[model samples]
Target chain A: MTDSIGFGHHQHACTTNNCTTPLAENIREQVQNHPCYSEQAHHYFARMHVAVAPACNIQCHYCNRKYDCANESRPGVVSELLTPDQAVKKVLVVSSEIPQMSVVGIAGPSDPLANPEKTFATFKELAEKAPDLKLCLSTNGLNLPQYVDQIAQYNINHVTITINCVDPVIGAKIYPWIFWQNRRIKGIKAAEILIEQQQKGLEMLLERQILVKVNSVMIPGINDQHLAEVSKIVKAKGAFLHNIMPLLAKPEHGTFYGLTGQRSPTDSELSALQDSCEGEMKMMRHCRQCRADAVGMLGEDRNQDFTLEKIESATVDYQAAMQKRITVQAQITAQMTEKKEQQPHYVQFIPLTSIKRGLTKQKFVHRPILMAVATKGDNLVNEHFGHAKEFLIYEASHTGVRFLRHVKTDLYCHGDDSCGEGETALQRTIHALTGCEVILCARIGYGPWEALVAAGIQPNNDHPYEPIEEAVEKVYKEMIIAGKLDEPLQQQLGA
Target chain B: MSFTINELCTNCWACEPLCPNQAIYEAKPHFLIDSRRCNECEGDYPDPQCASICPIEGAILDSSGQMLNPPGSLTGIPPEKMSMNKI
Candidate 1:
């Protein structure tokens, strides 16, 4: 899958017609690190998909209810389906363990939009907690219009819509039926509705400046020849990339097309189709047909290493406790914000007592997760990590940020006074913040940033001179989204 | 006319999805509200959703150069009374 087509240079529709809109640099940065979107980043960054969605609105000829959808080439396969709560916990574990995990997707055993509640719930949780990681959604686009606004609200930056064919004739041949509006419609009618909704959804997303990728499953003697046309339609509507996947036609899979003796396209045939489609749009040829619960880098599935049982056991009680705190914290923060003009002094912490504990012995003792802010007397995150010698540790929580302690650290780089011993200071600085999950600095060098991440701390260099509470609020909110305080460690079981 | 997000605007992403006209976009250093698309939520809502939800004071300014959400908008704490530091 050589991305010689250069998606980075291919801006969305706004770039055309001398558009009034300015190019979004931060949004480009958001996509720049996504492995699926950036060919270069694919070597370094990894992604994970949570199979929370378990229902489909439409059935395709190449799809088997028993297997995952035709969006990816994988046959009937999926890991354990998890509730939204369990999914967030699993994400936190995977994120902490695999630092390269940059995107969390809902490419499912079922349509994400079909189970909107479960899908959106997982997304909302991730949006607040793991805001740094990108959110990717792969939908059949049947219900895309209904959920576009909500999807935008959740800040889903990337979306993948599976449009096998733009032509209803070919679409009718591919899809057996679609359950739309209130009832199921079969044959060409279903294909028409699906196509109409998909195009509408694509336009809406483009209007919102959201990045879109179109995934088309090429079935030999079915829609394979029509894929080049599908690519053009989607590309014109501002789709960022087009992934033409090969049909995995096997009788054992029980797909309608497979049962009808539909032959799979040869590798050369699939590549030839992709090569032709490349001229129409940016073609993605490196797709590995990842499973619903696929994890790690593309072409690699490390889901077996992280199981549902292990995730549930590792994260259950910790998340239950944190969720309660976040709810209360949100209220307190709101009240505090309301009273800001009237009260000049900092507000005191209100002790919460509403968390009802179950008899199940808590296995892990909650570590006082700390976030270090680089400040210079104004209570702002205003200092560069390289220049700072002191850091303020805050007890980060959903309830609120509490001042824990201040630590003096070695400077990461040399000041005007002396040439610094860079590596020694870097190690010392990392060691000084051993217990911290995040270090908020105005600016940081790449060297120390990498070291901090390697030391299990996420270095946040975004907010410069922002209010400490605002930074703390952002961290605490992400803490809620992450659903876990820190990486899971061995602890005594509650007796 | 639509509002423009200046340098003071943080890329908090709080206002991007809130726009009814789907005008907000991410740019380096800050977000930019598309002038052509921004109707300021005239018919959709009584006030602009972007300015209403923005956390930063004076981050978004209207076409006429008036602050829709002026200082003391979010927290009600006056900007003058707040401590100022040069980052």
Candidate 2:
């Protein structure tokens, strides 16, 4: 594993409610903004849960979850499943209209932790673009212990676990079976393993100082009497709050409890359980039982306003937007090259004035940095140093190549005629190339080439007329093979 | 959610731009995805932007350890039919 991976850097210990680790510090600052964790925040702030996870590992008696999570109590269905890019665009659109959107959750519509790759991808992108938005995930706590390290790495502030029961006897009555390892384990054995895993996972999360919320479904005559015990255990384990939601059973839902004609808890019966659990730990009374693609504030579902169709149409191509900036730069470069090419007599043009500053002194802190390619068009390194006015910069590393930006420069070499100052044109050109570690061009004159060497800028004019990306890739690979990619050449050469 | 780029990667530079997270990096043998940065485009694209554009087959694998763009997956031809055609 490399340090570049998201979850590889945390080395802190935070086991108490008063967390002080870097990971815990990030969580503490973010948790208050989340609507689900703070009831006051819910009224002022809104939360949106995107149903990106499509798989589940366990079975619940009251759940007939298909593609999304079973944690949602209401019979809300997901309209459309979106990829990470589409989801981010949808979040932007929804957040624009509903500015109170403070938390972005991935609470089933399936367990977010069950689909690790899909869940984390959405969080990683949001972490970069929407840093202010607190990230929250709801899971079944089946894989919580396994992903606690990753949760810390991504700085996930709030986690909700649908822990219905603490005792195995009561858990068995709630969950019929669980899929563990590679097979299905049913009956009491399944509930025993699940209870053990949930407790261990909850303890691990608390130890890491991640604010946790427990959701328990109150089934009449089933787990209703046992929920107060559930509240006590989770609160003792440092759970922030416990939400006991009333079960909404319907025969058409095809759940085991629903088909068996199980009774749905009345409003008073549900309130009674909440009232009892309130003594042991704080009880949440405001859960809306949101859908997979739910948007807007809690208790109000505005999914109809921003349908998948609307979101898809509103979704701008993020990659194209970043590249569009480069396209504009490229057009400017093409126009400059075209005007320069149109000049019939290149020799007639002379340097207007001598740049008196003796070598455009640049104080650069030597570091492993980016390089630029001088090209006329066609994304090829075909332009000469003296004739070219623009250079496209690229960030190259072991992982991939990224177009950073284009650097503009002044024309320097004028064929046989000297540009006034003794090697002033050469120095001026090299000065423009400052900060860039290397220059990839088709041709460079001896004076400018030597000047580039003096300035500690490695000039590569050997592979002329090659595709710009290929040339850059070759240089990057050569640097990697030579074990000289990590350190700047200026530092290595002591220039 | 990191994916690996095996020797099959052609370095066509197709996958580099579409990566929303910018995890893919340019390396010696081929372009590599920074494991830390790569989410296999889980929330971004149905098929990874890299594998979707890559001309080379079986170049990228998902988190489930399956080839994202396997042979005949794009062509919609059955594997048996493709093998018979190759012969």
lDDT of each: 0.68, 0.65
Which candidate achieves the best TM-score against the true structure? 1
Candidate 2 CAPRI-style tier: incorrect
Tell me each candidate's TM-score: 0.51, 0.50
Cα lDDT for residue A291, model 2? 74
RMSD of each candidate? 28.8, 29.4
List DockQ, one per candidate, in order: 0.01, 0.01
**Clash pairs, model 1 backbone:** A24-B26, A25-B27, A67-A76, A129-A478, A129-A481, A129-A482
> How far does residue A329 in candidate 2 sit from its true spot (Å)?
36
Off by over 4 Å in 1: A1-27, A68-76, A315-495, B1-87
Interface root-mean-square deviation, candidate 2: 18.3
Worst 10 residues of 1 chain A by lDDT: A1-10
Q: Model 2, A104-187: lDDT tens per residue?
A: 888765667767887899998888776656788888888788999899888887888899987788887787656565444666
Candidate of highest lDDT? 1
Report how far residue A400 has shifted in candidate 1, in Å: 55
